[model samples]
Target: PRFKSKKATRQGFKTDRAKIIKGKLRLDKPHGIKNWYDIRMSGDKLLTGELKVVSICRENGKYWASLPFEIEVANKAKTNRVTAVDVNVGHINYTEGKINTLPDNLKRSYKRIKHYQRMLARKSVINGKRATKSNNYVKTRAKLQRDYRKVANIQHDIMQKFTTQLVEEYDKIVIEDLQVKQMQMTHVAPKGLQRSMFGYFRQILSYKCDWNGKKLILADKYYPSTQRCSKCGHIKTGADKVGLNGNLKHGTKHNEYICYECGSVMDRDENAVYNLLALIN
Candidate 1:
């Protein structure tokens, strides 16, 4: 069959399952489960593996059975290298012995999804309609889910690439143990941008590091990575002292800090990154 859109392709692959039981298959509507069983069984024969667990998920009016499997592979040795990552709204900054930034793909995707959501809201308002489990509403909801899935796919892809690259190149990865829950609570910035990216990046980094046999070192949340200067052991206090503007500067209430001894202009995050790197060495 010719695929028109990703939504159609996903719908084509959905399972019509009646029940899911641990590792066993008890088929009532075995649409997704059957496919998983077949694939795992064939792969097991070819590679001598086993199916572990079968679970179910519900999203956008569709039910799915997830079959997880385990395969044996040879263990590898550790490589001693270190990288530090700092996540932000527009980009992810990292030090793989040098500074780098990852594209803000998730943020961009969210912006696009937000546009569609706004349109849907407008349509519902104009028609004075509330969504029921009607066919049209269901279809619209599915489309929204598809959009979400697409964004998720994009995020997953970017994270995989970035993590894989880091793991392959560096054995020891250091990252700020960002207080994500606290950030979410204190976030007054536009769209809660900082809160959105921090959690996902940390999750991806953790798993990828594990898979590649690399060490993930998480710096403490209160380590003051951005406030202390790397070049000199100087601490900058207050928001304006750190060269931060607008909502980006969290400690904006106080603005007077001077490195009277060295006379260095301080930028908080940059200072933090430098300090983080200093800790590595």
Candidate 2:
């Protein structure tokens, strides 16, 4: 890959001529470079098997190295357990009647990022007419970049843990094939839906399930999981499907789902998960 002169732009290269020694990554010196570098890796787990490739990159004022190893992934033992999940803007609902929300720390990180972004914007406006950037402006920009990286790391960590847990505990997993792009483009899309990482969550869940020998079922995008009653198999149609404010009409609360046919009432997200689970069960 081509390297940019500026530090802000991402630059990286891949090399297979590298090995780990005593927890340090040793790389061969390239042309015109005199010294070999032994970079200490972060993880505690011992890397085994043939190291296929190592990607070295400078990102967000930090150097990152990722080594991919060729190894066999053994299948997880079967438990015959199955579950369905409904991923929403801020939380996830499960067929097991559990709800998990984005952690407080992550939310705070997001808030901080927004604050830093606004600060950076102000600094940029101040620097726009100047020939050189002020030290304070440069510092603020760096801080904003760091916050962006921090939020990404936190999100990735949470997603990794959640996907790994699901793959290990369940033999079959069900999730909606959400039209996330369409939702994002729509004028009246749900609040926070544009910022939600539904696509990333689905991507990770899919690969984890594949790696661990688990079955992942994607309910059709048009499936009426949200509009269907979990207890009575009744499907809400027309304006009754969703209220004028984009909620179930049968319930006063935003997340409450009520069956008109049978008068069954439950949390909307849980009801959706149940409807998704019914496909495989």
Candidate 3:
């Protein structure tokens, strides 16, 4: 790992020696005037567990403390409920015919972040090189970082809610093992897929499932979930496939999957979700 730089806008140190005493965080070594700092945390539940590590960081002119703890979690009772989900470029399709998407506020946040980023660049760049920071440049950079934090928090909130809901509602959850890197390299829905955060979604779902005593099944990466007909188990080929095949635009233009073998018609993403559901049904 690279050495930590003092010039970095975001800086922090982690230590296991930190102790929590009467709702205050106290470090073993006193760096500031006092060893203990009164931290404003979101909930008191974090204080209940065995504190393991404390991380203090400063970013965007704000100081934050993160206290990670260990606790026992009782596994949820089994309900025998099962579900499958397909992560699409635009939305997530599930076996229950429910589509979940990020709210419009996230899009607005992205736009604001982009605007700040452009402004920051103009303020910092000079003669094709990044010049020394001026008062205005630093102010713009801080605004950009604030927007970055906003976007991150927004995504984190949505991810937590969506993943928690899935773990709560289903005993067994099935999802395709998507080859995200290969998809990106092949230029398949690049922008949309990146924004979708599919890999991170899977990561969150996996841990949440483990904590909730839910079973998470990963369908094979090359299982052709998107190209197979969920109704008749017929796999499409050539122009019928939902993705690129030998430079030919495959699948129906309307994003519908039609199985010639059984004449079963369905939305492409919904069909994939069902096909994944069939894996462990």
Top of the candidates by TM-score: 2
Model 3 stretches astray by more than 4 angstroms = 1-4, 28-37, 40-46, 127-132, 244-251
Q: Count clashes in each candidate, considering only residues at least 3 apart in sequence or on different chains.
A: 4, 0, 0
The full ranking of all candidates by TM-score, starting with the best, is: 2, 3, 1
Top model number, lDDT: 2
Q: What tens digits encode model 2's per-residue C-alpha lDDT throughout 1-281?
A: 34655653677878888888888898876677766678877777878887988888987557788888888889999999999989887777785555344578767877887887787677667767451267776676677778778767877787788788888889999999998888877676454675457999899998888888899999998899998998889898886775424554444666877777998878788889889999996
Instruction: Residues 190-221, candidate 1: write the lDDT tens digits.
Output: 34554346677778778767776777888888
As a whole number from 0 to 100, the lDDT of residue 182 in candidate 3 is: 74
Error of 3 at 103 (Å): 2.3
Q: Which ten residues in a row have the lowest lDDT in candidate 1?
A: 38-47
Model 2 stretches with alpha carbons more than 4 Å out: 1-8, 30-35, 42-44, 97-101, 129-132, 188-191, 243-251
